[model samples]
Target chain A: MAKIELRGVVKRFGENTVCDGIDLDVSEGEMVCLIGSSGAGKSTLLRCINLLEPIEDGAIFLDGQDISVPGLDPQAVRARIGMVFQSFNLFPHKSALENALLAPRRVRGQSRADILPEVEALFARFGLADRMHNYPDQLSGGQQQRVAIVRALAMRPEVMLFDEITSALDPQLVGEVLDVLLTLKSEGITMVMATHEMGFAREAADKVCFLKDGRIIEEGPAAKLFDHPQHAETQAFLARALK
Target chain B: MPHQQTAGPTRRQIFEARQRRKSLVIASASTITVVVALIVLVPLAPGWSKVQQSFFNGAVLAKSFPKLLDAFMINVMIFAWSAPAIAVLGLLIALARDAKSPALFPLRIFGAAFTDIFRGVPVILTVYLIGFGIPGLGLPRPWNSPYIWGSLALVLTYSAYVAEIFRSGIDSVHKSQRAAALSLGLSERQVMQDVVLPQAVRNVVPAQMNMLIALQKDVSLLSFIGPVEIFRQAGVFKSLMANFTPYVGAAIIFLIVTIPATRYADYLMARQMRERS
Candidate 1:
């Protein structure tokens, strides 16, 4: 069984279908990047995987346990699969350390004494040692996103999802956040990111998925997907991107 | 030619002239008003000899002081009990309303209706009805504990307003924050307790404080329910002595309580606004 798997996933919002039928398998440490236009359902698909957005139809298995069932506690699934949002949803009232420590303390039932060292190490690794005492508003966009990433990492989730995490950052700050993601990638963290940064996608993703109209048009090795175009849409997309 | 020939009047001089005129008019009006008020109130202010005869005289104060203390103590008791109850109920109502749970709709409506109905009805009527009128229903006198009934009336009145304050506070929390917590795998309850409510509460501290002081002042209205609180004691003094000084003294006592609360509330509001800005 794959570390994370979504089979026949379909999500609908009111009258519109967002995710038609997404079938994907992520290995224990594969970093897959889903690249698509806004509203093409890449974010929706990621939410579905985390069970934040419930699917109208499908099964998502995290380590072979079906998590897509209606009655399945989304919280338990969330504990194992963490997501970093595009907006860096750090609890505004909490400091960076508390943001990282909340889930571990609440869901995992880890005491402060036990989780403090782990959280410190996570923050240190993310280069936020100076900011651990600062609240979200006190930190820069890049720093906030990095703390958000480490917050999820502190949960020690099996798979981490990044939904356009750096899209909200300034151009100058994006690179630092991307560097943190690259470091996480190198650390063998399994990640599925919906991102607009093509170069980062090509450089970091083990696979590149080109999503169009709520479905993946083409997906394969990142190098081949970028170099050899098999579809006209892919060619057109690359042509526009190249410009 | 020579100082560039300054305009008709220098702007500074003109502004100073206008300021002087405005200040002179304001001071004159204030003085006139004070003189008028003193002239009108002289009949009301007890003569010094009369006051000397009364002040610290046990006969005058003893008859009314216990009654005043009883009423005041009862008001204090009502506030002590109801303030926390209102805060909790209002907060829970706000949470339930924001939760958007289908089942909680009735609770939302009931909470809102209770607040509006109590707020809409005169507090005096509500107190009278609950205190004296409820016994006519052939049920246990609900307002038998005048403190309890009076407080219940006030809590009903204040909870809705407090709930709205809480609702606005909860709403002030960015929807993105809740989504972020949800994405972190927190259950809805965990999201509220750990993430949303704390920030919401912080954001509305001044407003909540305002409501608290408002409730404290409203505590005086409980005297209508028959507790003989401070105001009622003053009433007894007014009836017995045929003088207004007791009422004035009671007003001062009330000011002693409410003025600080209002000022502290204002201070908190100013500090919060400063922080926000």
Candidate 2:
């Protein structure tokens, strides 16, 4: 079974349908990128998959289970899926290492003795080995996002969703965050990212999806989709992004 | 070492200039006239001693000190019972008012009306109405007098102001933070309790402390109910001795409670300001 499947998912706010029947499948250990212009429902589609935004009409499957049904325990589902936000959303009062270890300690009821080794390894891997005791405000934007990734990864999620993780960084600082994401890529973590960095999307993703007007107009192998976009919208988006 | 000369005003010079200005202004004005008037009036009116003796005599304060202490203790008891209630109620009302549910609209309105009526009416009158007047309705022994009545009035009045402070603090939390919490798979209740409330309470610490200080003095209004509390005890002493010393002593006692509350508020404000900078 695929790790995640969104079948004809529809989400709306008031009369505005942000996602009009989004269909996507992410297999085990595959890196998928959903790219689109602003207000095109790329983030909404990602949110629906993570159950962050509820789908008004359609089904979302996680490990062959119907998760989109109302009254489902999304917490149990969320434990299997971790999300990293654009703003980094690190708990301001907690230290970087504590932020990473919070959910495992809290939601999963893992003892500090059990979670500390994983926290240390994630911090060292993200080059924040010395910043364990620092608060979110004490770190730079890029450092904070790295900690956020480490925090989600500490939960040991089966599918990770990155929503423009580097979009909030300084121009010169974007590379450091992208470097961390690239490292996560090498770890063979199954990931679905909504991003604007076309170069990374082309290089890192196994499958590239072009979202426009709340629908996937084109999707294929990353190289084929980036090189030969069939839809006019996909071609236009790539042209603008490349230029 | 290189010698560096500073052009800015030295700290000692600034301090001396302020001191000189204060003394010069004091000397140029009415202290001399007030002193002269006091000298002339002492002999012209023999009863002046009665007023002075009454006003300055600490003997009443010394004798009734235990009674005064009991009254002060009662005031502290009132605060202990009422402060926690108001804090918890105010936070709940704040959360209720902000919730998207349609039912919260009525609760929000009720909270607003509750605050407005209590805030607009004098605390002294509220105690009288609840303690003395409400009994006329044959409403039960609860309304028979002011002990419970007075405390209830105080709680109702302060809870309204505290509710507003809580509201402002909750409002201070960024909307994006709520969205983020929701995205993190926390329920509405969990988000409010774990994230929003903590941030809101931290934001309003000084304002809430200010209200707590105000509550310290507001308890004095309970004396109107004829409770044997400090102010009431002081009033009885004032009538018997025909002096103001007991009243002045009661004022000093209130200062003792309020001064610490004020210092705490200032510390919280300074800390918050420093964090922002």
Best by DockQ: 1
Judged by DockQ cut-offs, is candidate 1 incorrect, acceptable, medium or high? Answer: medium
Model 2 residue runs over 4 Å out of place are B1-70, B88-153, B182-184, B187-189
Candidate 2 lDDT at A160 equals 89
Mind giving the per-residue lDDT tens digits that candidate 2 earns over B1-277? 8977779888799999999999988886778878888799775896877876886686777887778888899889887888888887777766666777676788877767777887798877887787677666676665566667778888877887888888888888887666655555556776677667878888999988999998988887888776778888888898887878888888888888789889989999999999988
Off by over 4 Å in 1: B1-77, B95-113, B133-143, B245-249, B270-277
Q: Candidate 1: lDDT over CA atoms?
A: 0.84
Per-residue lDDT tens digits for candidate 1, residues B157-260, read 67778888887888888988888888776778888888888988988888888888777778888777677778877877887887666666666566778888
Worst 10 residues of 1 chain A by lDDT: A234-243
Please give the DockQ score of every candidate, comma-separated: 0.57, 0.30
In the range A171-224, model 1's lDDT, one tens digit per residue, is: 999999999888988889899999999999988899998888888889998999
Please give the RMSD to the true structure for each candidate, in Å. 6.0, 5.5
**What's the true lDDT of residue A243 in model 2?**
97
- TM per candidate comes to 0.82, 0.79
